[model samples]
Target: MYQYSEFDKQFVRNRAAQYRDQLERNLAGTLSDDEFRPLRLQNGWYLQRYAPMARISVPYGELSSEQLRVLGTIARDYDKPDAALLAEAQEKQTALGTVPVPGTNRQVGSELKYGYGHFTTRTNVQFNWIPLVKSAEVMELLASVNMHGIQTSGNAIRNITADHLAGIAVDEVADPRPFVEIIRQWAALHPEFVFLPRKFKIAVNGAQEDRAALGWYDIGLQLLRNEAGELGFRVQVGGGMGRTPIIGTVVGQFVPWQQILNYIEACVRVYNQYGRRDNIWKARIKILVKSEGQAYIDKVEEEFRQIVELDGAPHTITQAEYDRIAAQFAPPVLQRQPRDAAAQQVHQIIRADAEADPGYDRWLQRNVLPHRNPELRAVVLSFKRLGQHPGDCTADQFDAAAQLAERFSAGEARVTHEQNLLLPWVHQDDLPELWAAARKLGLARPNIGLITDMIACPGGDFCSLANARSLPIAEAITERFQDLDEEWDIGEIDINFSGCINSCGHHHAGHIGILGVDKDGKEWYQITLGGGDGSRAGGPASPGKIVGPSFAKEEVAGVIEALIDTYRQLRQPAANGRLETFIATLRRVGHEPFKAAANAARFVEKEVA
Candidate 1:
């Protein structure tokens, strides 16, 4: 919601001009793919599985209606134009399969057509095309919208995320949006922090629910009310997921709100100065935190803080400035009315048709949350539905979502870390119409934060770092658990899958975690249980215990199923009937039964074979 100032606008424009020149040189054959790759990557462009995919950073999943409109325009004008090419390729492939032609014009054309366009994560709107020719144009358009692709890739400070419900959530002690925005502005072109050994991630959580997934960030800050009743942040550092995933350490306690920026600057300086740069694998802040010990890190951080405080606090932010930034994020004025009548009518119809309504009902219950306004609500449509490619959104779909956001949701939509779309501020009066529109666009899935809403990564298909195919495995699990009613009855359980140890899918933070690994060139998975994000009443759940070494790909879902059944049998009911309550009950009982069930299932399957 932050508006770009003249300075901000000029900065992006200059970056665009620079990229345009780089693109022009590459196109003229003055620069090769090797040279262009890093330059393009710095600008959020990638050569993906299909064509060249361009990823535009939304910066912590926050966007203005106008900025989103520009994104939609880009998708429509630049990417979707390849639809004709796709159709032609499909026709040619069909022909090639039927006719036994060694060589043909149709075949050649088909090959050319197939070479164009590709798939991308549902959360990232990717443009698949040659970059050099249109780089200048893309730059110019993006600049006009006050956008740039800086630091979206490489070892730079990747996207900084804050709770999507930062200011909106009633349970928050303070809104951390202003703090996140300030950090974003300060870190954009910081000289010392730009080129770390590995990527650095930061997440700010203002919600009681830990929507930012604090346990998985390089640095996670939770806004809290100090004993003095003043706003402050509790700092957690070193949390990361990779080959050697580790939970973050609490390096700092009760950092005053006014000095938040200075504190962050100090923290980064500590990491920048001491973090390993020689070995890429061992270069993350997590490694530093682990090697140095939290006490040592805390001592260094205190010294850094003193130095920063004495050095005039370079990135110091004021309450007034904070207010000015916060003002930009004011919620839209909503109309007062009863819930959508047409949607209610559809609800009735679905209720009458038990089979159809059951799935939708489950989806609505889990995915939809009430809007601040009386007559409206927000819907979080989980694109992370079981075996689907998580966070993959097509160019046309991007444009369509943008259009839909503009029409019904105050021209704004949000992308969740869970790899889902949130149609925030939808009017209840328009719910039916919006639902129909979303259905048409295939964005109307009702699973928001359920087991079926599993987070996954681009595994063997595209990632050079993956050990196996995560998407297909996730799909398999989703298909196995296709019964929505049963899933809802199971309640709020997180079943996160990671293709490899990197854990981009956040397997370490899941109540039920599945991690993909390699065993003698064959795909295998490891299961972990009882982990969670944020500070819960029983103190945050620790990293899950690994249930076994690994299991064959075919046996992964069955292992999960067996664990769930064990959990259900052992669970003690909570007052609200939530799964979190059940999980707490199960955690108290320990992992023996779950492990036993999983091992027994594997043993039985092996005997049958």
Candidate 2:
């Protein structure tokens, strides 16, 4: 909810102008694809398999209702708004019974109206379309809305993420929003940090729950109070996902809140100067941490910290500035009355009509959350379904969600780290009517926190760096395990998939993690069990015993079935009976049996072949 300052506005406008110039040159043949590749990438443009894909950063996965409405308008006006567009165009062309003459300037049927836009697990939005001209138009439109595609796809600093619950969650000791905003401004287009060896990500978490997924970032800062009651951040460095996945090491302890930015700048300076640039694969900060050791990285960070501190903490933020940023994110006002009777009536109506509504029960459990205010509830809706690409909500769907939030939920919608949309402050009494409306918009799927609620990366489908197509495999697994009751029985599980070791889908943090790898030009998956997220004693799950080199795509469901069955037999009973508890139970039983069962499925397939 941070409003763009005049400085921010000018920054985006200048960048837009520069991009327009670069694009025009490329179109005019003044720049070759080789020359334009890095330039376009810095501007968030990519030429993928199907078309050109542009990634727009949605800083910290937070979007204002107005900003979201703008995105919806772009999708509707620019991209192929519906799947039926292509099919409908084909039908009309066939009706005409002949191809249109090539020289005619008149527009043909459905001639590539921009590209489809999709959300990624990394707090970014991507637009894919052919004929780069339309994509540029989309970029210019976004700039007018105070948004830009800068640094989203490059080796430059990517979107800065913070706890999604920042400012709203009462448990937070101190809001990290100010620090996040400060870094966002400083890092944007910083000449020293741009064009680093590899992509860099930073996250700040102020709550006990680690909503920012601190362990997966290059720089993870956990804001906390020290024993003396002074606010500070515990800094973790070199944690990243790629070919070599690592949970960051605690490099600096108790960096004072005011010195947070200085410490971060120091860390980046060290990585920028020393990080490998010769081999792209070995260039990540994680690799540097591995080769040079944490002790050495700590030494460099300490040196940089001293220099910055000596210069009177160049990035030190004042209390008033912090208040200004925090004020922008103040929680919306809530009604004091108890649950409205009319809302309860609607809930009953939907529950009673279960026979007529298949999604009703799922929506009730998955999409809705209890609020401290008796009259109000928060609705958490999953965009991740069995066959649909996870996190890919259409523009119209975005607008519909925004409208619903404005009408029923205090004019706000929250985007969750799990790639779901949230109506955070809806009145409990409105649940039934809200559910009914959400159902019509195709936002009523209720598989949240279930097996069907998968986290997936674009994979080989779009990303040039991926080894395999992750979305298709995720769809296959979801379809293979489509029974809602069975999924419910499995209970609160995190099943995450990544196209490669980068773990963009957060495979390293799932209760059940699946990572895609390339094996002799064939797509293979590596399964790791019992990973968890957050700041609790349980962090990223330990790398489980490798289950297989490869398994038939269809056999993945069977492999998971065998693993789940192993858990059922081996797990010790727990009071709450959560999957995490079951996983802990299995850890006690050891992983050998689970690995044996999962690997057995793959072995059988090899023999059949």
Candidate 3:
């Protein structure tokens, strides 16, 4: 985790003050709503259906104990701690057949205290029900902990993500933290990128596992140590999911580490100059790349060359600067213990005993993985459960997570793109105590990358931009798949639901993607199949292929059941995870088999007539 410098702290404080001034002017009627919209969005204030949603950046998903405590403090003190009491008071008034009047006990009801910390797939934290007037105070609180909301909302290269196990992964070629930070630092409030064609996203991955999902980003960079022993980035571009879903294309095969920043600048510069600006629907850089094809590539290369040709080139990184940033991310020294065969045998036997506890076995199977250091392990703190919203946890849980990190590992935790927390340096020998501690804190759910561990946005529940309520669907799916043995048997399936076509769920990459659409004021879900990551490097990630047609909310679970059944029946026998099996089965069986199955399921569901 990189700490903020004095300059960084001052910059954030100033930005908060600046936003405060803008908000005050807007409130005073000096600036109209339209005039103030961009200002608010850039500051992470979105006027949702119910209230303002403030998204705070957890830079690269990194959070120190102090930072996590601050987030909990904000959620506790400002968001209101006694939401249940307020709700009870409201209910009593309602039962008495009286309207809860304003400036009375009703004032407490309007406190809007039920909100919790929401972790997004982009690795940011969102606080719903934040009032516009209190946003500046939130920003000031965030500044105290080296976090901010800039580039989180507007059309800018949003927060840069990297392999969640950046420095600690077993098979990583390099640590992407330094480069990711460099991008975040340089791109922060870059003048040219203020108003691009649309919002942009970038990801960096150095792990052999490609956990970052490189193919689904605006710009995905995979770090590589070539035959010559020099590390550089292999660039992919144009890929995004929304209404028009497409996997990114490789723009640069291998860019030198020194010139990677400048190359990225060139790519965005090209996008900024000529990307569509007329129709909001086609405003994305993905549209431009798809429209122009090779010509787009040519333009980017030319721009990059021009940039490289310039005197004292902009976005150029000096060796000293790179080294300085890299030093901040250098892995800590840890005692190395021999991971002998006997030790493994002992662990396996001990694990089997631990598995006697139902949830403990699932915890071992799902939430735990070996780290690069033989003595340590990476522990995932799942926010997904039967009734819980994906990526959501209480203020107390946040504080407890920080405490766990301080006691068990480093005094830091990392957020995942899947909306979970990661203790990256927990000792393997301490799994029992860690699991017990986390379970008590409500931070352990033991469902990671399974069907029940769904991805969803706030949808119509909060966001005005949504077409339907996504959380209910997610909850339904989780309930339907609550049986642990059956879930494990079904195996690594990804079912992502998006309220609308904005595709915040990354539905395009789910094996079974459900997109909620408004059909004559009713919610209808369009299912997509065979959506997933590339099986190998340099291959396109599988974009969600539409099955047959949309299904009503009631038909969703059955439709998914049919799709899974199709996969179970047709998949070639292999030891691959169920998602990979489903993808492979789709490739071999094509869309027809799944479509036929879905249609048959829908027809059967219609009957009992």
Candidate 4:
């Protein structure tokens, strides 16, 4: 994890002070809401559906235990709505009705939850109920910990994301964190690019597997060495998901590591000049790249030439600069004693425990990931349980996670793109103890990539842009798959849910995508098959194809169940003797069977139990 330097600390405090002044001016009636809107957005304050929402950036997903503690403090002390407001919000939510249970009329309603943080696909934490008047206080508190929401909102460069296993993964070509931090520094508060046509996102993947979902980002960088062993990045551009979902094109095959910022600058400069601004829906760089494919690439190359030749490429990264940033990411040494004899004893104990407890064995298989160092393991704390919304963490859970990080993970953790927290420095010997502690805190369910482990955004219940509620749908699916045996049998699947066409939850990337829609002011869902997140597991980054007409909200679970059954029936045994995954089966057999099954499920009403 990168420690904040004195300069960096002072810079954050200064920014917070400026925000407080602006906030005071606005509150004192000197500054109007029209004038304050942009200022507030630049500082990551959003007037959401009901109250103020704050998005705190976790750069490259790295978080210190101390930062987690501060986040928990914010949730516990400041994320509450007024009593009257809470009552009104809950009343409106209660009227939305409950999710229907197949085979019966049993309904489950949505509960308005607060005082919690949501982990986003971009690895940002968001609070939905903080009052606007206290925003300055919140900003000052955040600055105390060297954390703020600078550039987290607005039409500027959003928080840069990287593979959660950036420094620890066994298959990594390089750490990627140093470069990620470099980019973060370069892009933060860049006056020239502060307000682009629309929001821009950048992601870097240093590992062999595409765990970062690189293809789904506006700018995706895959680090590798060329033929001469020169470190560089394979740059992909123009990828986004919303009303339009397109895989990024390879703009630069192997841009020198030192010139990454220059290349990105050229790309952004071209888009800033030519990208659409008149229409918000079509204002992304992706749309520009799509409309002018080779033309867009040519323009970026020309701009790069001018930046290097005419402007002297000021942003080129130097070895000294790279080294300065890389030094901050030095792996922390564990305080444990020598591991020769104790390691073997722990291994023996682990083997015995696994043999004695199937649940522990299952947890080891699902939640534990091999680290670059054989002595360590990257452990995922599952937030996708039955009672909670996907990726949501209560104040108590946040505190528990901080304690776990402090005790077992060298006081550091990373928020994953899958909306889970990864303790990147857990010792191999501490697996059993960590699992027990995490399970007690409701953070360990042994379902890392299972069906219940889905991705969903805060939909209509909270987001003004959403057409329908996504939480109820997510909860319904989670409740239906409570049987671990069944979920395990189903295997790894991405069931991404989005409340609208914005694709916030990356539904277009799910193997089974569920999208909320509105028709005649009723909540309906559209099912899609054969979507992927462009990983070895999910195959490739691609938008799913719709099955048929939209079905009523109540039919969504049955539709999903029907699709799973189709995959189970059509799938063949793999070389490893396990059944083929849903993605593989969907590809091999095509979407006809799944589509037919999903469509038919709408009409096949179950009898009352």
Top of the candidates by TM-score: 4
- The local distance difference test score of each candidate is 0.68, 0.71, 0.79, 0.87
lDDT of 3 by residue, 365-387 (tens): 88997788898999999888864
How much is 543 displaced in model 2, in angstroms? 4.0
TM-score per model over all chains: 0.83, 0.86, 0.89, 0.94
Better of 2 and 3 by TM-score: 3
Residue runs of model 2 more than 4 Å from their true location after superposition: 80-115, 333-365, 370-376, 535-544, 577-582, 603-609
**Candidate 1, superposed: residue stretches over 4 Å from native:** 27-38, 46-53, 64-141, 298-302, 305-309, 335-364, 371-376, 384-387, 535-541, 577-582, 603-609
Q: How would you encode candidate 2's per-residue C-alpha lDDT over 1-609 as one tens digit per residue?
A: 566778788878788888788888988999887998998888788875444677887777666677778788776676542455435444543563322211111123323433245777666777654346666677677888788787687887888887656665556777777778778887888898888888998888887678787876788999999889999999888887666767787888888887777788788888888889999889888888778886656766786658676777767777886777777666677654554899667667775675367667667777776554566777876687653677777777778877887778667666677777777677766777788788777777778777777888777655656666666667666776778777766766677888777777888777778887777766667787777666342344244345546565446667877887777777655666544444575568777798888887664432111
**Count of steric clashes across candidates, in order:** 10, 7, 0, 2
* Top lDDT model: 4
Scored against the true structure, residue 436 in model 1 reaches a CA lDDT of: 60
Residue-level lDDT tens digits of model 1 in 1-609: 566678888988998888888988888899898999888888887764323556666666765566666665665466532565445434543553422111111122323321111222212344454333565677688788887677677777776787765566657777787788778887786787777767888888887777776767888988888777988888888888767767788877888877777777777778887888889889998888888896557766786668676787656678798887788677777544454999678766644554354545654666667654567777775555432456655455556767887778777777776777777777765665666667667777776666787777766544446676676667667876778667766767777777778776777777888887877766778888877765442236356779966877777777878887887888875667644453576678988888898887674333101
- Lowest-lDDT window of 10 residues in candidate 4? 98-107
**Considering TM-score, where higher is better, how would the candidates rank from best to worst?**
4, 3, 2, 1
Residue 477 lDDT in candidate 3: 71
lDDT of 1: 0.68
Could you tell me which 10 consecutive residues in candidate 1 have the lowest summed lDDT? Answer: 98-107
- Kindly provide the TM-score of model 2 when superposed on the true structure, using C-alpha atoms: 0.86
